[model samples]
Target chain A: MSVQPGPATALSMSSATPAIEAVELSKRYGEVQALDGLSIAVAPGTVFGLLGPNGAGKSTAVKILTTLARPDSGSATVAGIDVLRRPDAVRRAIGVVTQRSGVDPVATGRENLQLIGRIHGMRGGEIKARTAELLDRFELTEHADRPARTYSGGMQRKLDVAMGLIHRPQVLFLDEPTTGLDPEARSQMWQEISRLTGAEGLSILLTTHYLEEADQLAAELAIVDRGRIVAAGTPEQLKAGLRGDAIVVELADEVATAKAATALRAVPGAREITADGHTARARVDAGASALPAVLAGLEQAGVLVASATVARPSLDDVYLRHAGRAFAAAHEQEVA
Target chain B: MTTMVSHSGYLTVRAVRALVRQPVFLIITLMQPIIWLLLFGQLFSKVVEIPGFESTGSYLDYLTPGVVVMTALFSSGWSGMGFILDMERGVMDRLLSSPVRRGAMISGPLAYQAVTTVIQSVVIFVVGWLAGARFPGGLVGIVVTIVAAILLASALASFSNALALLLRSQESVIGVAQLLVLPLVFLSSAVMDIRVAPEWIQTVSTYNPVDWAATASRIVLSADPDWYEVLWRLGGLLAVAVVVGWLATRAFRTYQRAA
Candidate 1:
């Protein structure tokens, strides 16, 4: 958890040439630009999170990389194969669990897996064995013959991920794998995903809106806003990129926040500041070191600081640093 | 491609197995055709029995082919319902996202529908036989008729599935298909003689591929096999199948693009 500034072996994530790569990708649906010059590189053996809100081109990027949709002007490669000219190869190399569950509800869990395996060109014996193995791995063996419609949300998500991994593709694309699940189920899925990447060494690219989901699961991350990747790095790096800890000052009024922010800017190592409504936030290299200076300065400026706290930066802070708004605010707008 | 077809064959078997799991589907599959045969057969019997019909045989014999075609039409037209079911259940998208050939994924549902269509056609044919309907062209003709019905129905189902993709709503798709199916059946030479109909009806029948299928099916059932007439009707139905199948493929592409 101790992520240092840079070149700290405290973080094991190695940024490499990316198993999945997009170059100048752009997609337009009539007047709407679904993706605008979006580019990303996913390392070969790490969990890369495409962190964004809904309709921020997360799924669009997945489709392009998974060979489901062609980008209007960009190029992409998956597992070393060109997605445009050799999409079948890309399809062969990556497994995808879309935002929507792909498990056939009427069919048994085992049947769904077997059918998917067959579609991927596996014969009966192979499909049967793999289906059984996946069902067992997902802890659905007892219910393998039961209709998927009977599964709980967590069980269905597990089945979905198992179906994707049935063919053992090198890269896995999970688009919002836990969107509608309850908190407990979402946490279980996070554990399952962590186990997969850790045990199997599979490169996973997951798209998620949950900041904690990304923080808990992703080794590397990208913050996409308005169809562009505004920032990319490991969760720790992105968090650390904002430098040290964050000082959140809740003021009595919007004017107080403005006044408090202006005074706090004079403190050394207060790298950036953001003001929203009656709250102002400042990021500094050392959060503990900068707090007292900020408090004294705000007191001198006669700004009524209702409350203030200093804590380690989060991905939210990283998002705010890159996009100049709270991550939750952007999420709210995207949802709207 | 052979391997692909073999893989699709596996999918078809799985689809059939899934249907069998419900058990009621088996009954409805047979029950639907019988209802069509008896209801439409008796309803239009008096009108169809009028003299100077397409054949010298009883109107029941003449109505047999139309009922078979109707069964096939109904079977195929409802094929898109499977797409909706799969979509809602997340099956279709799952298959689509896999390395499976797109054609194979589509053919799974289509093949299941076709196999069941053949079963329904045979059941209808047997019921007709019990009612004194005979295949004048013998066993070859009966087998050919059944095969033709299956293929024709499968092609129709492909078109239905494409429509389903475009609409993506079950009520609208099922509603539009229901509205279109019986009208096309009634407008064609299915239950009545095409020649005795009004000039407009005759002209319309000429363009109704369902009419072509019905007429071809009739040629095999009634005595005096007019091989040339049979060839013409079969050719027209096949042409319709090919065109509609292509449209279904295009529709599938659009759906994939949207996805």
Candidate 2:
């Protein structure tokens, strides 16, 4: 009979505002359909991830939204400004740390930050203070005076993130921020990115292929595939929506996929079974209890099994369920 | 307007800082002008004795302005390299995404080369003086030489940056610019006296922008201070620089879509 009112006040203050929104955004690069009917809405002051494999139009969407490239069709708005109509205003309201490190390698980290600050029309004293604050926060204060090329990959990436914040933009886009970093560096970047979530009216639109990264950082996210949003929701909601355990079967050969799915479906409480390219996945009520029955049904159908696994539902399983293929395989296909 | 000016200032400062960080670049930049002044200056010392060649007190004075222009040519040839580096490093995309004036980005690298060319021209002039070169117009001639070098460097720098933005590849830009500059240098009076050069070469030199700079500076330093010729040639170099600089700014559109 009652509802939470305190948090709703904060949201209601600007209920009409979506920090970034795209509607049926489509782009074709020569023959490649980089983005097709891609759409998303990001809440203000939250980290929103565009989670997808490489070449899934994640970067394309970002390029359009950032005004670096134009979509063949469709429209978008960033920070309440229409990207297509007033790109310069959108540019001023956002900061971007692209997949590639954007720090000027030849200039000192301080110089790189100062350049962006000046570009944003910050006064000299303001740029100096902001640059100093960012360097200290990013742990680059010790090496702030050195050419960014001399810094390690992690350091340079941190500098890039800092550079993006030089103007205190309303929105920040980190496109695959941890792509080229080592594990240690990736986690460090993750920590740095995590610190910026949910504060100061600053919203973030992070594009990443790492499942865990999206899970850890974004409060809500969209799974893009073939330039379309396959699924979009809170991480937990998306995973929870795929109710039941994921039973993965590793097959010896690409054979009898339809037969295997039929057999798994015959088992009680098994649903949404699929056999694709030496792998069969099924959903069951209880992984431990349903495993033996599913296996027996497959064996009855004379389907040879290399191995099988029963695990809790995950984004990977959700992606598999929706896309009818593994995410890694689709990514590989794009790369090839 | 203030944002544009400040952004331009910041970008120029950033470019200069990059050059300062690389001490070897400064040394290598000087090497071209020094070599022309010392080796080429001495090797061609007897050119003054040619029947039509005016008797400049020494060959160094005759070669000083040419070497200065050549140095500007060589340095400006790689002006596009800075844009290539920024693109490769993703810095240009970062700037493009910001509110910075796009023209400021184009002019930053060009201004760095222009400043370096002027400063190096002074060094080349001092070296020429020590090596027995005589300046007929004294300080005015040195100022004219620096101004000429600045214009030449600015024009070449704009052309190189335009190529960088248009081609978006470092290797192609280097190959094209180097090829283009060689012909321009050979056709001009940078090395040989125009009178001693073939008649076609002499005629071509008159129309060459590089020759405009060389002639403007050479006249200022020669005993015959032909104000009209110097002013017109200097005006020509400035006009070319402005046109090429405007083209360089327009090239940013290609870059924006390129990403």
Give the best candidate by TM-score.
2
Off-target runs (Cα >4 Å) in candidate 2 are A1-11, A253-271, A297-303
Ten-residue region with minimum lDDT total, candidate 1 chain A: A8-17
Model 2, residue B242: C-alpha shift (Å): 2.2
* TM-score values for chain B across all models: 0.92, 0.96
lDDT per residue (tens digit) for residues A181-242 in model 2: 99999998888777786445679999998888999999999999989999999999999999
Backbone clashes in model 2, listed as residue pairs: none
Measured by DockQ, the strongest candidate is 2
Compare the candidates by lDDT and give the number of the best one. 2
Which docking band does candidate 1 fall into? medium
Which 10-residue span in candidate 2 chain A carries the lowest summed lDDT?
A: A192-201
The C-alpha TM-scores of every prediction are 0.88, 0.93
